[model samples]
Target: MKSLVLLFATTLLLLSGLKSQESSNISLIPQPVSVARGTGFYQLKDPLIISAPPQNDSVKFVANFLSNRLVNTKGGWVSTEFSESAGKAPIRLQLLPKEDNEIGKEGYHLSVSEENGVLITANTSTGLFYGVQTLLQLLPTAAAGHTVVEGVQWQIPAVTIKDYPRFKWRGMLMDVARHFFTKEQVKQFIDNMATFKFNMLHLHLSDDQAWRVEIKRLPRLTEVGAWRAERTGRWGEFTKPSPDEPKTYGGFYTHDDIKELVKYAAERNVTILPEIDVPGHSLAAIAAYPNLTCTPGTYQVSSGERIMVWDKGTFYALQDNNLCPINERVYSFLDTVFTEIAELFPFQYIHMGGDECYKGFWEKNKQVQAFMKKQGLKDANELQSYFVKRVEKIIQSKGKRLMGWDEILHGGLPPDATVMSWQGMKGGIEAAKQGHQVVMSPNSYAYLDLYQGDPIAEPPTYSMVRLSKAYEFDPMPPGVDSSLILGGQCNLWAERLHTMRHAEYMLWPRALAISESIWSQPAAKNWNSFISKVEHQFNRFDAASINYSRSMYDPIFKAGKDSNDSLQITLSTEIEGLDIFYSFDEMFPDQFYPKYTTPLSVPKGAANLRVVTYRNGKPVGKQIKMPVIELKKRAGIKVKETP
Candidate 1:
């Protein structure tokens, strides 16, 4: 409470006014390229006028959006109207007058002056939309909340900001195949990503779990493949569904829904990249048409039971999910699927997921072996690559390019394929060196589904990617061809994300770092400055009822064994200037508790530890309690005893 209030106070002081036209500390996510703040302010009051050019529907849409936001602000409705012209309008949104502009095509120049009120200009409407986004962030902090508050004033600080994205393909992946998100939910995602100038939304539309896009000719694709039995616990541990069990869960988007979502995203300048995972992760499709796989039989859509088990760092598939590599029918099925997919999505690149394919089934099948020998395919990897290459031709036949996970670089790399690197920077680097266009989404840096904080303090996921790592991500590797590297994205695999609230919690804060990494110049980034901006964004999220993680403030505990084999503990934080206080006896620790200054050995007879974090003598993080045994487990030690 004290920390937020202090942050608010600091924000007020900074936003109130500035001197010498310096870059003031106005916290905007995906920090603008350049900003010069001027003294004084522009007070926005009732009957605010927004002027846009007549017959320019795009400008009108942006203007109306700003008007609505002002009217719906926390303090109450601020009456606003639109007109073709208004003398010195309170707000004006439009494109630049000339073909040659002051900023990039997707860039905008926002000026808030006392004389002219607020004017945002760009080379395109998309740029103007981004400018309005910055303009909204400039409003008084008091107006940041979904609920109404009386006696609040809307004051716009005087500043000029020239902003442009650092890369063209600023994107994020949402795997709705595992857990279907409604059309409205997907639109909400578009709105959130668009706020930070994310241009692409990779919709993972199908996987082993379920298929999430409707095809007109293949009715069973949705009838039998789109749903599964409800699973209540963690992923990969749910009990197997009975053969007759009713598939009461899951959903897919109709053609109309897809069109509506595409329109909604385009209005906000976001493109939808629909993915239909193939060759592998195709249980849903095989469930609909058993003949798609090497072994044809009745197969149910995954109900969260373990399909592949990991042992000794390698996965072993329990069922045959990979599509038949040499089967001609498989290509026909994919051709039909991609034909409708190409018609529905105006975006050029259709993502064909070709990752984590289990090839034992193909290697064992006698017909597959014979076909492989006939084609001169050396191994099962080559066969899978052959399948993707065949699918690539189908995609290109529909006048679309092929994009897939980094695994598509197996036995053969498609000449025109765009690789989305998820394994790590290695695959991305490999592809970039080969002159392929790449989007670096390595799980090590950008997997939003991974735990951002200590596993004990966060929701369940097998892996972790810290916020610092996300901020430190550089889409362009040190030795790669920078031109072939088309920015990057963070992915939120929905296996464990059951609701939009949880998804938002995992995506934001971390996604903000990704946005800055992809949209802001690398030299312009500072960790401390970025954290300050993120803290400020929390209020805006609250105003709009958006969920986010405060995990960065939580103390990260590390346990290690001393020379004597006793447990030694250390505490640190993602954000600087936080003080960690601890108690060994398990009583709730507060600011008065002993502050952590150095590594502390386990105290005699202590059963557990309690800790909390504070800054400026006010609690900023949730109090955490850790049992002594948990500490030993954290240290990867067995047969632990209290030191």
Candidate 2:
């Protein structure tokens, strides 16, 4: 009896000692694992070893092969998939296929164990794809330009992780309808999506401004509407017309182009959701087929005012025009257009932009009023609902679901439709409670066209959406049913943006923050930490020669590092990659001052400090000055005036 007691106690002591050793090894790992694991996931380090049969199925092989190929060897693998001996590696992964699971219905099952091999079973290829993405997070962060090469140096960090996205439809919307982006540009956007693990790209293909995709049945639509006159001016400069009035504008994607884009996106695991704006933002379509309008007329060809064009004789001089009321010809036109679009995009959802259908035209037309009465509609809003329902039925026949802006809920929403909550969170909550899926893209946070920082620092565009507000956007609103939330997207309205560089300036640095918000657990959100990651990404962008705006250094306060000499402090803080020097006293005539040794010292009790920066012994930019004390510290800690 005593011997048995001693044996049991010894076994307990052995178990405890083993656990302690495991804890110490794991302590060497990062805190992110603690957070990820607490959420019930087995987080594995990058360059993970997935043990499989000597020869596995293509899907499993592909999953592991991709991780092995893409995992950043130099940066440390946060996510990876490779085949090798497990006992010697930090993570031992095993891929197991479920026998009873139906094809295309597989999902990831991930967990960690004390056993040598970790089993990860999936029922479909898609499950494996998602698992690869989760593996990416477990890998370490690399400095910009560092590629995950085969062998150099690899670290086996202790981590067990399991993760899956809450929303399956996380997305981003790119409006090619407003101004066409080249096929290469579209693919570039897809590449960016892959970097952030974004799974969907909602392509807004048609709008009032132009028609981007090609329909073999309608050649003239693209040949004409796609190319407008000169582009609009900078943001807010929309009102200004260029002197080069006669210049033409536009481009479109051929059927071949679209097929290629879809294939490209598919390879990156991104589903492209194409949007066709209906009823209201249909001036371009109306122009293509004037007979569809209640007021059929020719468009006065001109530059700069594509947003507002009228039936030549109806509303003369004032410029703005409305979508002519629904007529038989209009429905027929949409039927033909959608028939072709449905064939091209096989996705379950089709975006029928049901927003901002002004009432002026409906009120003005007697025919519309009579049609409304016959259709049992009360007012223009109800008529709009009827229009959406009809389109929804047509789309349903094609085996597709209808998605529209929040305005579709006005008067009445289609029962079979999903709502994109752009106006605010309330619409999403309302839609979800009513048993519909919602994509929350509130303009205040998701509108990328909004400037990223202070107006003075950025270009003279419209006001900017500060970085913090974007970071705070929660796709899943509190009290909102989780099942109803489809996902969210960031919209970059290009009304004022023209060149690709301008597009990059508006997208980058900022989009990085949005990506982290949507993909990373929300609790891990920190603007400062996000800024650091963004800076690292900027280095990658720079090394790739991708055009992007440089992050500005924070201005030094008069009481901070610049306290010695206000003028020198100001210059040092203001300039980037330059040295500053100045002199306050009249002493040392013809004296040479070292960089950062400027003599223009701030006076004691001075309210501001001044500084100038120089490169190669010459002043290239203007001097700057800042206040001595900050008004608020809770707002954010200021970046060091010196970088």
Candidate 3:
């Protein structure tokens, strides 16, 4: 027995040594372009040095940022030196004189070895920032924490990596209008995505529920539009505001807050694209100034429920939220809004939301009809096209290009307009075919608001977008000019996300998948390998105190009735390693229970079916319990029980 124990201990030590010696399996989230493992590791110890080219403030800033991060994580003060020294420093950031055209300006070459210590070279500051992010990832996951974490080996694997993004416009859109996220929350989001090298932050600042950005000229836009009656329970199921009810549950970003956020994102190499949804999804604006609409009356800000009526083959929101195209006052309102938005955000494009403009009101109103007839407009679609063209001019006057949803393709495609294809890739393909630049944000894959795992086990959302599905998305569709594709983005519509925690739960792992999809090359994609990297990021997220879902561990349960009228249950998971187990009795499943090998039928005399997932003989996911009656309901068959 003593000899057997000695052998076991020896084997464990051998395995640990083997793991340490093995070429660093650095599971980078968005895999770098080229990585070659070296012989030695860079041990991060006291008095760690970081040097950059003299007078290079950007590199200096990065060094300081890293130094502070190390101090916070490792519980020690590590000073960074920006000036050139006689002795070689552990970390060196150098700016290359000539850019590598193939790698582009946002690419960097990183090398860490015994001979050179650690070296990062890039043509631009943005590239350097990304390189720093990659370097941080190379360190121990505990280095991501805010407080000091003991018993961690602060070491980075020695390697040489040449990395660059496949697309220039990787982004994430957060809708603050439906549910407001605090300025600090937004900054936290920006920081998280920046680590994954996402370059654009699309702020959906206005929608039917609320207006989330302050405009000095239009104070009521926030006073009346931003503040809505406090909502509880499921979205769209809230009680309607009564005469005595107070509107007290919403918030907006002050101009100062916006400026601070802009600066914060800019320093991280992220551009903020602010969307003041226009012509449609404008109920919040209409609530503030009712005259902007064709039907003039007092309009209360929506309490998170849309007023809809079944129209010609479709449902339409009947609050007359859409701006009246013929009303010059409407255009003036937009102009003022855009003028303020343009002054606040420094991005090149302003998203003029041209999606879902229910033209039912325009079709019904006599004055709008007369105006349309005067202009020889064929339908409300043409009227919307007219509205878009005028708004395009307004945005152009502010020295910004116009971007909108695919619904803008209805009447006629606006020239110089960039289309964000949200419905699906069909709009993106059409826009690319017409030579219009497009951002592919197909709802099927890019909508983070959708359910990632089984809706029963996870939060209630409309659709399923598994991590694999998100990873499989190719923004540049076949037969379309790839050059016209300005990369892709994942959108988190905040209707279902009541808190920052809920938003974070929905964004990660899947967002990690999106980061790889948009940033890594198409040829470099490997689903199995990406899943491994995602697991590594989960640890980093844990250290950072960020909320992320582990719903991927849950098995997808499908129920159906066999031809013999017996209820059948099929269970599977997108992740490869999990083993599904089940028990018909009320007790929890264990290894002793039947391991799911085939379609499971309802056991005789069983009252309920319980399913659980395990990894390496240990339970890892939520145990799912479904009643026999519920299974019958799902299978759409009535099973009479025998006494």
Q: What is the lDDT of residue 9 in candidate 2?
A: 100
> What tens digits encode model 1's per-residue C-alpha lDDT throughout 352-433?
9999999998888899899989999999888878888888999999999999999999998988999999888888899988
Predict model 3's lDDT versus the native: 0.87
Worst 10 residues of 3 by lDDT: 304-313
Cα lDDT tens digits for candidate 2, 281-322: 666665566665566566522334534434632332232234
- Cα lDDT tens digits, model 3, 1-643, are 9999999999999877866665545878788899888766788777777777777777777778777888888866577776655158888887887877867879999998866688888988788888999999998899778888889988888899999999999999999998889999999999998999999999999988899999999999999999988887787667778846899989999999999999999988899999989888888898899888888777888886757654565778757888889999999999999999999998899999898888888888999899989999999899999999999999999999999999888889889999999988999889889999999999989999899887667777667888888998889898988889999999999888999999999998899989999999888889888877888888899999899988888888778978897889888888898888889889989778989989988878898888888999899778887787777877788756667
Error of 3 at 159 (Å): 0.9
Sorted on TM-score, best first, the list reads 3, 1, 2
TM-score versus the correct structure, for each prediction:
0.94, 0.69, 0.94
Worst 10 residues of 1 by lDDT: 16-25
Count of steric clashes across candidates, in order: 2, 36, 0
Candidate 1 segments exceeding 4 Å error: 1-25, 74-86, 100-102, 142-148, 640-643
The residue ranges of model 3 lying beyond 4 angstroms of the native Cα positions read 1-21, 84-87, 309-313, 604-607, 636-643
Clashing pairs in 3: none
